[model samples]
Target: MSGQPTKFLVPLLLPISWLFAGLVAIRRALYQHGFYKQETLPVPVIVVGNVMVGGVGKTPITMALVNHLKAQGLRVGVLSRGYGRKTSSTLAVSPSSQSQNVGDEPLLIARSCQVPVFVGNSRVDAGRALLSLYPDVQVLVCDDGLQHWPLARDLELCVFDERGVGNGHLLPAGPLREAWPRKALRHATSGQEVPCLVLRTAGIAGPHEFAVQRHLADFAVQANGAKRSLSSWWDTPVQALAGIAKPEKFFAMLREQGLNVTHSQALPDHADLQNLHIDTAQGDVLCTEKDAVKLWAHHPQAWAVPLQTTLPTELLAAIDFHLAAAQHAKLSSPHGHQTA
Candidate 1:
């Protein structure tokens, strides 16, 4: 259903959406009232997620944040729920980890960032596991856990794409998973409200949100880590396919790069590509880096285009400011001092 409810369906779904909102509110209240426990790790956690369901470029942003943190000389680790994986147990993600076991996104992060990553059904558990093994990691980045109230975060980065809060309704009625300008959440340990930052991954920047510049990398990568300039395919026809929340966006980006996309396939988000068959006779195959992690096993020749993202310096400075404060507070705490 494209995650956006049609005008005709909105009216029919409004009642159910209201019920869903009530449930979400109740869940939040439970956590806030201490009825449900929230776990906090020793290292600060920065959650990159979106209020709307579906991908809004959170993975790329998460990777970018990890790289930025690493450049600042801080040891960084990643935690994820490992969505779409077959296993429910917590497992450390390695570059060699199969997408079916550790999830495509987590594996991609592990390989792309070359940092420690762990995944489980519960992000809290995943964070604990990651820290247990990588005790030196100074910070943790939760890939997609805006609504995961169980694991408290020191900073929240709410991401948005071109479709910002479409239809402005929740659940079946629209794309919103939570209300816009959501209320602040409390820290797991200190019980203080955690701060949030708004980031627009695409489209025009809102007055209060930071805008990120996103474009396909000039080069495409192969399974063996070989790279080829995208311009090499300018005159050659290629079959482009994407299994993402908004496949059209990827296809459109390819066209913008002047690639001759003769055939375009938009599969379901995180669609299994083990049996995907493309007629090479049509042209060379092109896919996104996320799909490449799985597609390489079946279509090793597929050239995966990586999406490069640039965040504003102001955003990084803001994050640094928050991290410093969070670290200071943690150090001053008796329990944190004892743990340290």
Candidate 2:
């Protein structure tokens, strides 16, 4: 989702984007008018998603959230749509789960967070299944479901990288999935502004948004639990690969660390790498943690560089406040966990 088209191209694609925006408006209206039902889970849900269609470092943020909540003694479970998985059935993720079964991101989160995770086509269903299986789970964190109206969320965190609302137009014309301020404004008009907190994953923070610091860990971990400094591979031939929305960013980071990435491959986001081949002779294969989850199954020699993130204390406090407030409201209601 990088290298977006020039602004001049916006005119040519505006009609289509307008159509898409209209459809989005209509769909949201349906949910608002009660024509379509929204389901609320038994536990509080915090959604980490983006306004534009691209990776904005949501998984790492989710992993950070998992760590923060666990420190508070909250049993948090994750739910995802399992985008690009082969199966459509809802299922719980495990350490042994393959990317083809539960998608790479979910599998990575499950392994990294060591918490229950469920994935399916429907986020609501996945959340329910996770709660049923892990009854003690106090909260649910949805990896990417801000626009998933069917699954009501108590809190939403919108993530943005350096490209904040890129060009600020709708899909095809620009990078946005819907009009940025307009859509959010519409929600405010409906008397519920979606209780969202804006986060900048990269670059300068926008107004009223918090900045999150992210950096690659100094060491990369092997599938067998072995670890080595990134500098150890500096002199070796290395094949760098990333299947994320912005693969170049990962490559650039590796280069910044003085690792010579002789060969770099950028596959589609969430791509199944069963057909791709990386020659070790090119050097050691270095990849993002999300890619490593899938790549390790086929290529055990590949090393995963995890992203270390620091979230602002104010943001964490806000999230905790919202979760507590939602829980308080839930306790006051006679009927447990009704739709919003």
Candidate 3:
């Protein structure tokens, strides 16, 4: 529990890591034995998650996928554990969905895509309720449930930002929530087979993977939806703040857009703005649209840069193939009734 690192810690860590890995093995075995049942929904579930913890660009990718699905005429709904939510039950995400309830990411998805979203500790239950509410939804995107074992997925898209599995170690030592090697193997199990997409939203290139980019809106918008030109803030040194996994990126992008930011604050992902006391008189406040969900209540003058993200065409092609295959599977199955 101390901040100091000892030279002996490395040797001790291997044995300790081995012991932890053994526990993970045992947990996997218990699930395999039916002691823990991995639940599957009637709809196809695409899990957009990362093996590495934090800042892997999952939210942008999730929103991009949801937009693509909706564009392809697929009725898509989203399920998320709603990581920082106050409630444990399944709650529908509407304009009214609070970051305190539905979680920040789900609220982001709901806001950007205008699609049905539900959040709960159990992704399976959230998926069930979402489907029951919107039965026509053909696909379900679990926002960050790659390791959430209860709900099964047909596609497991492991998103990484520029940082690819930092230090290649597990939590406490490195950034991963689980061991990296288990990713491929776990995707092969659960009766509901899964496929992997090594996706990067920006600076990506080539085949099985694709490159994409994120953009901020030309005009920053207030919580009331009033648009303010980026040029308006050119006169003052602004504070670019963020509470997302990739806050650095938001700050970087702001600088790239030629803004003179006086300071930058990187809060934990989905930070409640109620706790932030900005020096409004010192300078203007700037933030990402994700933070806008809560910042509105606390700081009216805070300007949020709405992100415009694009998924690579090649990645979209693969997803299209899966969606088509899923449709065919549905029509050919005994219990399946409809096709789209």
Please list the C-alpha lDDT of all candidates, in the order they appear: 0.90, 0.86, 0.76
Clashes of 2: 1
The candidate with the higher lDDT, 1 or 3, is 1
TM-score-best of 2 and 3: 2
Misplaced by over 4 Å in model 3 are 1-8, 32-35, 183-193, 201-208, 337-340
| Cα RMSD, model 3 | 3.2
Flag the better candidate by TM-score, 1 or 2.
1
**Poorest lDDT segment (10 consecutive residues) of candidate 3:** 1-10
Model 1 quality (TM-score): 0.96
The model with the greatest TM-score is 1
User: Clash number for every model?
Assistant: 0, 1, 0
For the record, the alpha-carbon RMSD of candidate 1 to the native fold, in angstroms, is 1.6
Weakest 10 consecutive residues, lDDT, candidate 1?
331-340
Please provide, for model 2 over 46-165, each residue's C-alpha lDDT reduced to its tens digit, 9 standing for 90 to 100. Answer: 899988777888989999999999999888899999888999999999989988999999999999999999998899889878877788888899999888888877788999888888
| lDDT tens digits by residue: candidate 1, 269-313 | 888898888899989889999999999988899999999989899
Question: What's the distance in Å from true for residue 112, model 1?
Answer: 0.2
Give the per-residue lDDT of model 3 (tens digit) for 1-340: 1122244664556566567667776776666556887775666778888776666678878888898988887888988888888888889999777788778878878887999999988888888888787888888888887777666677788876665555665555556667775634342233544678877665544365556677887789887788888877766688889998768878888888778888888898777877888887657888987898888777888888988878867788998897677666655666563524
Clashes of 3: 0
Q: List the residue pairs that clash in candidate 2.
A: 237-283
Q: List the residue pairs that clash in candidate 3.
A: none
